[model samples]
Target chain A: MQQTNRLRPFFENITFDRDDNELVLNFGPQHPSAHGQLRLMLHLQQEQVVKAHPDIGYLHRGIEKMAENMIYNEFMPTTDRTDYIAASSNNYGFALAVERLIDVKVPRRAKVIRMMLLEINRLISHLFWLATTALDIGAMTVFLYAFREREYLLDLIEDYCGARLTHSAIRIGGVPLDIPDSFLIDLKRFLDNMPQNLKDYEDLIDQNRIWKMRMENVGIIPTQMALSWGCTGPMLRASGVQWDIRKEEPYELYDEVEFDVPYSDKCDNYARYKIYMAEMRESTKILYQTIDMYKECVEKNETALMAHAPQYISAPKLDLMTQNYSLMQHFVLVTQGMRPPVGEVYAATESPKGELGYYINSQGDAYPYRLKMRAPSFWHTGVLTDLLPGSYIPDVVSIIGTTNIVFGEVDR
Target chain B: MRRYSPKDNVQKKPYYTDRYYVAPQVPKLDVESDEEFASDLAAIESKFTVSESYIQLDQLVVYIDIADNLGVLELLRDERAYTQLSELSAIDWLAKDGKFEIFYQLLSMSRRKRIRIKAYIDEAQPVKSVQSLWRSADWSEREMYDMFGIKLINHPFPKRILMPDDWEGFPLRKSYPLQGDEAASWYEVDKIFGKEHRETIGAELRDCAKVDRYDTERFSRLGFEVPKGADISGGEKRKKVQYQEDGGVFLIDRFDEEKTVIIRDKDR
Candidate 1:
């Protein structure tokens, strides 16, 4: 059997009666508006796109291959590089997978803290997406406003963890450090100001004629099409499918916190953008609940961070230095790593983008036998070729931005 | 809290029953029931070789034969309403019978349940492509091919996704080395700097000059003889040679320099 290129029609099948002025456009493995290292080959007839093929993998770093070589705990840091904008969500997803594999139950206080960090990370990611997407659509002022708030969130993250970008704050069983004393104050301040910041963004682009013309009715994907294409997060929500891993599966204390899942039946770029903005507000609500829970736990004199599993989770640095048994456990954990039972488990969490899942197969080894990351961006990127066809050539950038794809996860 | 023994049945029943009664509960929906799943699995038992199926980590996991991949996936998608193919990944089981395990994670939006389907295939065998069933399988299957070398039959464009088009050997294979093989040079680096510059850099960084005379095997392997003038105790002025290669200047230190170290400016 012979296989022809799917993007191009066969020469024998081409009829000369119609105009055959199809121009093949390679839209950026390096183009500025491509968002990241995405190379889309579009077959255009005049201004409309006849066919679109996304050639990804330029940003691939073999993170999965690297996971097989490193110990389970060592691989947590590498997950940060996958979706760097939402690094904590990646870390939390990997940590949850490892904890589930080893059956290490996290403490109540630790669970609350983990939930708080993940929601904060979600806010950071959504802000970053809003900033870049706004900039892509010619709303430069929104970029400035969103980043102004983003810096405050980054400062809060930096106060908790040492790093700003790839904050490997999450440990296997729980979080490494407790929230700082001033962290809540700073978070409250940011949350109080976030609504105003969101309003500032809305003022710039929400009613602008150009923004509406560029977004509405363009790149519209139906609910069925979106689900079949495996689109998650705001992309799926924009298509009127209220499928969120947090609401459906309820991982990491999400059940305790109350927040609404925003959805829109418009199923266009504007609907997706609106869904993202609404989601930020919902995340803020969840954040407020998480903070209150944390304060309550502190008042009750409960352990606020780190699970008490001695074998599965490493002891704290102070405990490792003082206690002899803790020292031995820490030494062994650091050197050889935890050995999970011979089984496989898939754990997914609702990251800012969508369902970020980790599938780990451990053959009773210190390192994962096979670790697979179900990056939501990967599936989102796959739908581009489907969505881009029949749309205008200029609308490609709008579609890409609205889809909110980060190549880190797409090409991981 | 007092621990109640099973022998004290009266107290145990009251305590346990009260605890359950007091807890808040949401009314259960008839959708995604275990009975429905059991009946569905029973319906497809003849077509698919249902080796094992159980709940793990609160998600349904089913292991099916490799040949029935298409039939089972289609049944799940068309009949059972598992519309969303959440993830499709491959696992290398080289140690156990040298087979590759492929996982299909399906999520039913209406049912609000996730089911993971697993199938094992030999290293060289090609699994049936589910691109027609779920569009998400296109890239996932391509990635599986790129990483684990498990081919997807009838895939539209089956090529190396993460690795380069001509890259040799799958990187995620259990047999593949972590640092990669020496035979396959970093072609991207060579593309940036010309082949001649790459060879020059490689040769300058080789450990031939760093070996001691006592390590005769390493010295001979590099085709270098022990020079009588290898002594470098003198405080001689170090010669700094700079070669402009590919828009960046590489500085070479020549005083007791075992291997060449290149330092470039931050802006370069």
Candidate 2:
């Protein structure tokens, strides 16, 4: 088939007729508002939308195929790229799935540590959403403020796991290592300081009339529709659904933790914004609780956080500590790889966007037989064409940005 | 191509209902060949059962079958309670009889349960497309089609999802060449002779000259007492020492040299 040279005749002569008044507009593959190379072919009637055909796959990198070619342990690094903003959450989800398939019990302390990283990752992911969402709407200051918090979170993560953007901290059985002493202290300080910062963020955008006008009733998705559409995380909760995997299914000691599932009936851009803000606050509270648990575990000398071996060796205490036994254990763990069972398990977590899930099938090998990732942004992005029909073209940007669709996650 | 008319630019397609976009309204399809479906599929009917099928891994190793896939997916989304079409992907069973295995993950937000849906498709058969049910399935299905050569019927525009438009055959298929577009560039005749396997004169000299070379200078440097005839007997240890010295000298040169070209043109 020959390509259509002029999609809509940008420079053609302008004329109007009443009989057949329909317009076709291509929104993006490069448009910043489309949230990562998403192109929407919009059929329009005057200013209103008649239909939106989304053209995607520009960002697709065949992550599922790559997962097949790599060893299970080798693929842990790839999880970091899935949801780059909340890398730990993706890591946790993937690791948990593998762990479930293998049937290796996660120690309580490791679970708590994983939960802490997850909560922190949620905060980081939300902060990114806030920053980019605000940027898309021309709220430049809020972008800086949101990133200010994100930078701090990344610093804390770097202190703990060494890498900021793609930390493969969580392993199959547990995390690669226990939280550093400095990491625990910094986490405590961050949790203490984040609430007031969150308040500042709300003050900046929550009450601003311009912000309200831009977001309020635009792109409304009803609770019934949201549920029917398979929306999860804030998108579903913003529609007044009280479902959260952390509370309902309670994996990774989430049952032991106390937290509230923030929800709203508004089911619009404003509702999603408010829900995410509330979630950021909730994540902060979870952080403090996690820190307290970590401290307790440290006080009790919990060996679960400590790497175990065939022979007992005192924990390295620091990564650089060079003990003969520690070196031997590290070498063995790195080369041999942990073995899990021959079953399959799906692990879900309440990610910033929604319930990010990982499904693992183990054939009793170092690598999994199959691994699948459930990205919330992809689901949320699917609803955009539905939400953009009655709304203005500019509102499309707000809807897409508010959903926080990362290309890394989408393509993966 | 149609001529540019201003009227043609005015009308846009109606955004589908959120319910339709999020979850597909699966039609009730009565499937035959019941033996291929999983026994637990009956249990999935009571809830929002998205997919209930068996995929045979090898022979008797039952996984998920594609025969009743459409029905099972409809149940998971429309009935049993799994409303979220979270993930859709395919696995290439390289040595297995089936060409590819597609995996679907469904999440029931209300019920807080997740289940996996696997479907096995033969090399040429078109797999059922779920894009109509879950709009999110659009790109996922396209990706599967692009990478695994699995056809998803009813996809709005089932084009290549990941690879470039003009790219050849499905890249992820077991039959796809592993070397990719670089198969012809894997090696060069000049590379094989010029540097890669060029044996050094010193190595040949060492092998041919059987005269024992012993030195106390090396043993003292490593804080070991020089033993008589130990240098020739400890060739392994000497080689290790040479490698370490080479590494140290290379490191020092790397730091000291400002515009040093590590490789010589003669070698290339």
Candidate 3:
């Protein structure tokens, strides 16, 4: 009888025909540092990578196709699934697109609240990036510390909305709900404690010999390469482009607030680290301004968070309860949905990862005729093919860590 | 609860109708309204024949010939400073126009403007690849080809990006059903179990929470576990599930049924 091999299935992918030094290693799909469902096909000659091909789509949910079949309001919840760590950012990006299509000016108070939510989301997303990237680079303590602060920030977010992670907090034309009675106070406490916590994170890993050794001179993306690859947000900023959408094209309450768009010419992991740290500090500054604005607006007793465009926006709770006309309209809006203008609008917002844009094409229908999500991760993932070659195998993890891609956005 | 019905072609069926619903159109202005757009359009018209140019929602949208895509983008990149190829994809209009309107959204940081270059191509025409110009288009083009079944002429790696290589249908097409066609529904079964096993295995059980007490393969009786395909026309006695056995383990504390709390609230 022939001997049965126990490891046959494991060896099935290994090719018998190959050069002695050259090898092709499938890096992920199950790898912990893959972030989410990223399978990197790396061709290695000895220890250095010869060529890299990223085989994505492991997390593809066909959400764009699903969005085409859904109404605008129904699709808002699904937007939270993309770039899920910063769910409200996706929510705002979609909301901004629909609001632009409907041509409704959002209330000033709602704008303040939306800005607060977005900045808080940015903090959450960046902290998560910091934690995971640090862990990926072999700094485990920073992960625990960063997550501890993240939990507090999540509590603040939960106080505003009912959910923590996938917060479909923003609605078309305005925010869905106003800040709770305790929201500002909680936000203040969290913001007050944030600087010290952020400094703690920096003190832990930013100066560590091993962290610097692993980070510096690795994954250097030149300015031209960054722009050509459509890199935005911190990725572009770190590569010496001072383009911040909030600065260039101010959406929401960004123009009212003052903050610096930090950039560095180093264009490597270390430079990106410095930029991320600087951004978090800048977000804290933005939050302070939003809180001041929110307090000032609250004095006028402006409780109308949702815009007054009834045909485009849903009826307020008070209207739904008191008026029969509002009830009928609400029923229709929920059943069929609001039909935006028969045109196309592409709205881009600077999400923590990059410029998250939603392009909506409406053909005089309740559902979008074509909804294309320009996810930053999709392009960032594409850049890996160019970024990975000639670098050592270990640098792949550092490069991916700095890239900060969430597969939900990449595979959508 | 609603009665169970087949959802085979639900999208095709008329479910809700709003006869009074009026679709509003956003105003599109002339390109000469803005001096920058006028100059840009003039520059574009000097080299290639621009079919149409207009400013919609404050962004310049220009329609050009399909063949001039690469050249126009190159001109914009080198001369016009439109550095980033923000997005590239096709809108499926085969049902209405029998053509795909492929659009390239170009972003110029220097000019602080976004210009959309769109071109119409026939259903079977292979799109000219712009991967040579902007590296971002590599994946976006592959994804466009994958979703809409658009053919590409000069893409470096001309394979499916989002979908599997052997997938049967272009899912983003208007005619393809959202839940999928018959071939799509059986894709996993056809790949893993072969077509011969279709009758034995049946279609995919989509309801995640659906539990059939008789299905021995998936649903196991908590304490009174049984063999596969065992005759269960007659029910077995329900055994009490415990944290510890009746005899109790050697080193563990004695089982306390009264102290154990069971959660009944679904929301909690």
Clashing pairs in 3: none
Q: Give the worst 10-residue stretch by lDDT in candidate 2 chain B.
A: B7-16
**lDDT for position B245 in model 3:** 64
Lowest summed lDDT across 10 adjacent residues in model 1 chain A is found at: A9-18
Q: Which stretches of candidate 1 lie over 4 Å from their true place?
A: A1-18, B1-36, B189-268
Best by DockQ: 3
lDDT of 2 at B185: 28
lDDT of 2 by residue, A1-412 (tens): 2333667544345555666788899998888777678888888888778788766668766676566556667788988888888888888788766654544567778888888888888888889899989898989999999999899989988988899999998876677676777887778787888888989999999988878988999889987667555678888888888888888877877777678889999888999999999888888878778877877877887867633433212244454276776666555545544434455556677777787877665554445556667787776766775767887777777888777778788667
Q: How do the candidates score on chain B by TM-score?
A: 0.62, 0.47, 0.73
DockQ of each: 0.24, 0.14, 0.46
How far off is model 1, as Cα RMSD? 12.9
After superposition, the stretches of candidate 2 with alpha carbons farther than 4 Å from their true spots are A1-13, A19-23, A306-340, B1-65, B76-79, B177-268
Query: How does model 3 score by TM-score?
Result: 0.88
Relative to the unseen true structure, what is the C-alpha lDDT of residue A288 in candidate 2, on a scale of 0 to 100? 79
The sequence of per-residue lDDT tens digits that candidate 1 reaches over residues A83-154 is: 999899999999988888777778778888888888889999999888888788788888888898888888
Each candidate's interface RMSD, rounded to one decimal?
Answer: 13.7, 15.8, 1.8
Ranking by TM-score: 3, 1, 2
Candidate 2 residue-wise lDDT, B33-150, digit = tens = 3432332355454433334333221111223567667777786677667677767777766456656777777766565545567766777888878877776677677777887788
